[model samples]
Target: MTAERPAVDPRWWGPPIGGVAFALAYPPVDLLPLALVGLWPFLWFLDKELENAPSGSWRGAFAGGYLFGLAQYGALLYWIAGLTGFSVMAVPAYVASVMVMAFNGALTAGGCALGRRFGIPVAVSFPLAWTGVEWLRSFGDLGFTWAVAGDVLANYPLLIQPAELGGVYLLSLWVVALSTAAWRLVRPRSDTPRTATAAMVVVVAAAVPAYGALRLDRLERQLEGWPTLRAAAIQPNVPQDMKWEEAFETEIHRRLSVLTLRVAPREPELVVWPESAVPSWLRYDPRTRALVPALAAQIEAPIFTGTNDADTLTGRSGREAGDYRVYNAAYLVRPDSIVSNRYAKQRLVPVAERVPFVPGMATGFFERLSAWTGQFSRGEEWTTWTVEGFEFGALICYESVFPSVSRALVLEGADFLLNITNDAWFGRTAAPYQHASHLSLRAVEHRVPFLRSANTGISGWVDPLGRWRERTPLYEPATVVADLPIPGGGTPYTRWGDWLPFACVLAWGGLALVGAARARTAPRGRGSVVASSTGR
Candidate 1:
């Protein structure tokens, strides 16, 4: 009998085109439905390699996966180009980051290929492996979890309520599972019928939204007559280039003073300012330090704003009194107190604000290129400010993306959360919108209301149910005053954080081990049709 020829695979066109669908699912474009099926084409492409590639299948899988990744991130993070005014090197840095992050795709492809080499079906293996890689990508010092596949639904409060149960990982799991089922339905294999898969996917897809609707209803009822706090969020709309200039310091302070006075009629118990609201150090600069308390005294409310800070080491560790470590910090100024309470920023922006494990000289070079000093020191503890008996935690810019940070503050007696960000660096790009969306999820995840004050826009309040009470337009000098509700207790997500992702890690590890063992033991040319078939 003549040996059979392997099928021809056309891998070039499918994955890269499909990748754009994921890009559109995020902000600026935001066609969310595309997220559900965007990866289907890549999955199909991987299947082709498994069934037909003579050898070096993993090479083809990696290449295709990387291509898909390049396309996906290239489109999603094109806003990185907006940083060009700061540094020409920013373009290459963005590319390097995207290339590193694209391992997510490579891992997914490799995992799926291993699954096929064993006896695991596409429906079971694809979702499991994909979610595992996503969860993995969310960790480590360089973890970049922006625009996870499920974050597309962030605009829909009801659909994303389950995020409180499992964080974004659960939603990602749901998306992958549904996608796999839908693909199986569209292209039925001999063992699994199209109708069965379609019915299962439909039931799941319908049930999630139905559950979300119910949860939203329950939340509305539960939140009735909850405690409320009246607060003002200030968006200064200061230009990034001029913010750090000494020439504009007087003008900047004047604008802030005018805005604070503008909201006096609202009689906000607390006035929140955007990240890096003051270019100078509030604690160290004698003039600026005096001005803060003076403003708080004038406004008759505790003024909370982002500013640079430093802790003098003095004699500690044999350092001189003048030796100090600077921080990206939030300062609380009361009428009688000057810089009495402060929270140093814990999560600094990766490249712009921090460069991990680099020499001081090299770090300074990059910082100067981006118009910043060297990386800042990390905060040791979570800080909450109590204003007129209303307690809230401050999450500085870029810190809100980490779900753990917000939950920790909630668990530490924070009734609400305040996120201060200066997104002026991103210009009119999608970064600001995407950055603001994270706070909504954080609100739901911790069952606490969130107030965001962005320097150039997206300043608003998200209620306990993840609903936006008020959202300001981009680049507008605006003040949003609202009576934000405070939830009494934490949600399920608060009690259990990232449990689902941990379980997924375990499950994926077991599957990978089994697949490896099976691949080693199975005969060379005796592959089952179920293992090789793409169903379509």
Candidate 2:
């Protein structure tokens, strides 16, 4: 017996339409309101695929999913191609990255099909399916946390309060929920009335912002009473190509010194510089070593700056023969001429920073390719730092995209978070602002303030309530000084990490058990019932 597929918008191009719409909801062309219903077309596509399920044509959904992903991630991550001036290698890098994310999209659609086979409603399974894969993509060495859908709402603090409860994944769940509700309202199921669907949407719309307004009001009052710590950030705005050249080194130092001294008048309790602010080994470069500490003494505040550091002064080999382990690190220089602590960036960018774990000749090929993109050893510690009485965690470069990184630091007793990044390579692309948006999610997730210093723009502070305090322009050199209120106590996200995705995985497991039993015991007539109920 063949399963009949719904003839509803079956053209393969439909997924791409959905994908482009979803991409528009994100940065550069950030039509934020589009996020509300962008996924409706995608959901419609998945529902059609579900109609043909159990008979195996449902597997076509995977391809449809990939098409959807290409439209979405391809546009969102196109800035990556601009990384190396859109060079020949950069083109392949961009294509490969999007293909991988598209594959994950295929998996998301396949998941919805699995739910269909088990006779679960599309509404019940689609969000879980989408979120489960999103959770998976954000882990291990292959993690690309930038793919999370909830991140689009970084500016809408109220819409994302669910993040404090479920991390960014919950915000994604919320987005999908709205999309599905919209889908139901437009094309009502046999059981769900259009008016009922409309009313439910209204309630969700009202309640979410209502919850956010209340939270923001309470946090504003508490912030007034809370103890504050004065902090300053330097935006060096160093050009990507010239930053590491010996000729520009002195100029880089001069600019940094000038900016630091400028902020010195503000008397900041602590100061931070963007990632790899000192392209050379800060401790090994004797002249710069003396210079940084002296500058710290001049300001009378501890200075936190990113540096490239090797294991030894003279490049001693590590575990591997004839190989030295270097790190992309953050160092705290105190006015007392003591280096308090150092934290290394754990998450390395794929291909650009570290080669991804692709087996065989591809590994060797990419390793050779990584020559253009120097690979540093991954850091192992979750170390937090203390400056006087204020404690903070330092996130180097793109590490802010990874939720687990900040959560781990907070668990280690960090009261605030700092992100130091060099977005010069992104070069005035939406990438820098997209990179900066992550702080809002991270800050709200743990109820901690996030202070960011970007080398070529987008430097600013995000308060514990997910509000942007001060945002600097791209390609501009500036210094931001502020007395931000510090926060204490753990948020639900900080305390119990990724519980929402885990719950979705468990639900899928439970559904699988039911599907297995039904396959053996249910009659052939039951298949018709499954197909008849599909929609949404």
Candidate 3:
């Protein structure tokens, strides 16, 4: 007799479908409301897996979540393949980034599965589990904080006004809570009535938007009272590969100079350039230094541009001691031919910018990989630069995406923000738009104007209320004369820092402990209790 084939679980299909739902909620698809329904599919799948195979299903649950993450991150980060333009390493880089990010998804699902085993309800377990995992992903050398569920609200400035009070984590919690309500509506797994679910959907749809309208109106009125400064950002549209070639450096300089001169009639108080606008070290390269100051003088405005900087490290011995570390730095050149301040990039992209920590003796291969990119030392502190009586933080490329980095800058008394980046690596993909999404939240959280100057495209200004100005198109050479509305004070997010994530972590931990205690006393058929507790 032929061996019988095992039955395929329909729930197994949940992960990828769920992942795609989440990915579809992001840009290029531009389905803003889909994010609310994104997690429902995965949650249904997890709950089902936990019920049918209640015993020793934690691994299965984790695998399902990981698959879901693979689907989500795979779609969300496919643009990474364009980072190297269809090369041998492109697939691996794309795969590795997705795989690494999937860990957070795995943890979220696995921990929730464990919570189910402990008898914690799905309603309570999933949000706590998911938010906690995001918290964990936000730290350490490999930390990546992009395209979280909360960021769905970034496009709607009014909807994200709550960011000033609780930061994006608060909105993240809000997303999960509403998602749970929606899930219960379709699945009816929980005892929560259709009316209650309908009510929640109503609140988020109608009441929340109403609140956002009121807040936007108030914030706009408030901004009208704030002082404003005209700022110009230069987009050179420099090709990624040719930028590194020795022969092309002079042409690149000429291109930038011409653009700066074009915006000179606008008479901006300050002029900004994209990250590494010049290939050479403006601080040490005598020729480039002379050229930049002259341009600043000609424009009659301080020029803030990204360039390489280096300083020799002297040990306790005072002589040429340890080492001189190269930095990805920013400089503000004055009309008086002076370089006032330098800000080094703190957060570096793993592998692309700097390889992650490995044993000192075993870093040969990684360093070789990073050699073409030329890794730089990490910056130690956040610095704000002042020109024409207006103060702003210089966020170098990856740093602006980080909420903490921007908050720290605002806390340091910055009235406005500047994000300079070379996004040529992203090419003609949704990556530029995805990268810009985080800045909107950052602007709202601190109630300060945020300006982004990218080497390739997706460059624009974000108002304090998180509204975006008309963005420059990709691979286009343009000068954006932006009016920056300067805020006089900081928001609660800037003053208090991220407190919501900590609360979520603590709540998740406590709920897990409660589940453990309940499980110890429950019967052998422990799955029934969890199945019944889905609404808890």
Which candidate should be chosen as best, given TM-score against the real structure? Answer: 3
Candidate 1's displacement at residue 316, Å, is 6.2
Instruction: Write down the lDDT of every candidate, Cα atoms only.
Output: 0.79, 0.81, 0.81
Ranking by TM-score: 3, 2, 1
**TM-score computed on alpha carbons, candidate 3:** 0.93
Q: Which stretches of candidate 3 lie over 4 Å from their true place?
A: 1-7, 53-56, 85-88, 188-191, 204-207, 321-323, 358-366, 372-374, 518-536
TM-score of each: 0.91, 0.93, 0.93
- Local distance difference test, candidate 1: 0.79
In model 2, what lDDT does residue 64 have? Answer: 87
- The better-scoring model by TM-score among 1 and 3 is 3
Candidate 3: how many backbone clashes?
A: 0
Task: Give residue 369's lDDT in candidate 2 (0 to 100).
Answer: 74
Model 2, 1-536: lDDT tens digits are 99888775466766888888988888656687778777777777776665555433456788888999999999889888876663456878899889988876788777777666666667777778888889999877678879588887887777777688889998887787777777777753445676887898888667667878888888888998777889999998888888889989889999899999999888899999999998688878987888899999998998999998766323244344444567889899888888766788889887776767743223366767767655677788988888768789999999999999999999999999999998888776778878888899999999999899999878989999988899899888899997888869979899899999899888977876786576557666646534444534
RMSD of 1: 3.7
Which candidate, 1 or 3, would have the higher lDDT against the true structure? Answer: 3
- Residue 490 alpha-carbon offset, candidate 1, angstroms: 1.1
User: Where does model 1 exceed 4 Å of error?
Assistant: 1-9, 53-56, 188-191, 314-323, 359-374, 514-536
| Model 3 residue 467 distance off true place after TM-score fit, in angstroms | 0.6
Q: Give the TM-score of candidate 2.
A: 0.93
